[model samples]
Target: MLGRVNHIAIAVPILEEAAAIYRDTLGAKVSEPQSLPKHGVTVIFVELPNTKIELLEPLDDASPIAAFLERNPSGGIHHICYETPDILSAAEKLSAAGARILGDGKPKIGAHGKPVLFLHPKDFNGTLIELEEV
Candidate 1:
């Protein structure tokens, strides 16, 4: 089962500009850019009091974020991550419940170096959902 909201991800055409909005304008504490080549994204985290905002930009044309940006030039919320006590069990439960998991249906190392799985957007009200093991 899902736990607390981990972070809210927003895809941006330009990571720097997007990060600036949160860091400069909003006066937030933003982390340095971290390139996740395996995930094909470069991310920056905006630290929040209760949660975090993840800024995602495509690492290359083949990146999923690139496709998302193509469809949404202005960029927007890409996904919402929720924590889980056990990802494998969570995946199995969601799978048995008929929710489709993305990719190979296996957990991958996320930005926080924690195991994570992505559920299909169609299964979650058109919003991509990421489950991260806590």
Candidate 2:
């Protein structure tokens, strides 16, 4: 049901600073910041040879990233996304297998403008898993 690793998401206290580290220090190609209101995050993607790294900053105080930042002021890895050929089928299978889906248990438009769904971290060894339709 899963394809290759899509992108690993990191929640940061400040987006610009994080992007600068990846761009200036690591010499990576970082994409322009894009606000995802639905997800309550402003993101910038660091282009890598094999996979991309998604840097997320909270859009507002109520944003989930804001809550994450509160727990870890320095910020940290938030989630790992995996590509899926068919998200609906994958969601169905995962549900049947007793894996809880986050939110309304429906796919949402992700950073790549593709259908995506998040699975409960408890079901995935304490790591939030994002399934994005490729």
Candidate 3:
């Protein structure tokens, strides 16, 4: 079951600078950086009312966020993650219902140390869909 949107991830090239701006300038207190090695991103999260704002910085060329930043002149929203109680089951249901998943089958640990899986844009009608279990 999709519970709610946990966070909106924004991909950027300079995470530290962004963190400072959001914290000092914008007054959004952010969490400590957590490196998501699997996704090649170092993330910093800012808590909100019903959700959070996750700042994602690419660690290398292989990082998907790198390509995303390159494609868009202005870095922006990368994906919106919906929190699920059981990610595996949710993914299975989506697959059975014919939604295309990008990977081989299991949710990988995302920026928040949560199990996360992404539904293909082709299947999600251009808006990226993410399932997260924290």
Q: List model 1 lDDT by residue over 5-114, tens digit each.
A: 99999999999999999989999999999998988999999999999999999999999899999999999999999999999999889889999999898888887799
lDDT tens readout by residue for model 2, 7-112 = 9999999999999999999899999999989879999999999999999999999998898899999999999999999999998999999999999998988767
Ranking by lDDT: 2, 1, 3
Each prediction's RMSD to truth? 1.1, 1.1, 1.9
lDDT-better candidate, 1 vs 3 = 1
Of 2 and 3, the candidate ranking higher by lDDT: 2
Shift in Å, residue 98, candidate 1: 0.9
Q: 105, model 1: CA deviation in Å?
A: 2.0
Q: All candidates' lDDT scores?
A: 0.93, 0.94, 0.85
Tell me the TM-score of model 1: 0.95
**Position 130, candidate 3: lDDT:** 88
Error of 1 at 61 (Å): 0.4
Model 2, 106: alpha-carbon shift in Å? 2.0
Pairs with backbone N, CA or C atoms under 3 Å apart (clashes), candidate 1: none
Report the error of model 1 at residue 16, Å.
Answer: 1.0
Each model's total of backbone clashes:
0, 0, 0
Q: Model 1 Cα displacement at 46 (Å)?
A: 0.4
- What value of lDDT does candidate 2 attain over all alpha carbons? 0.94
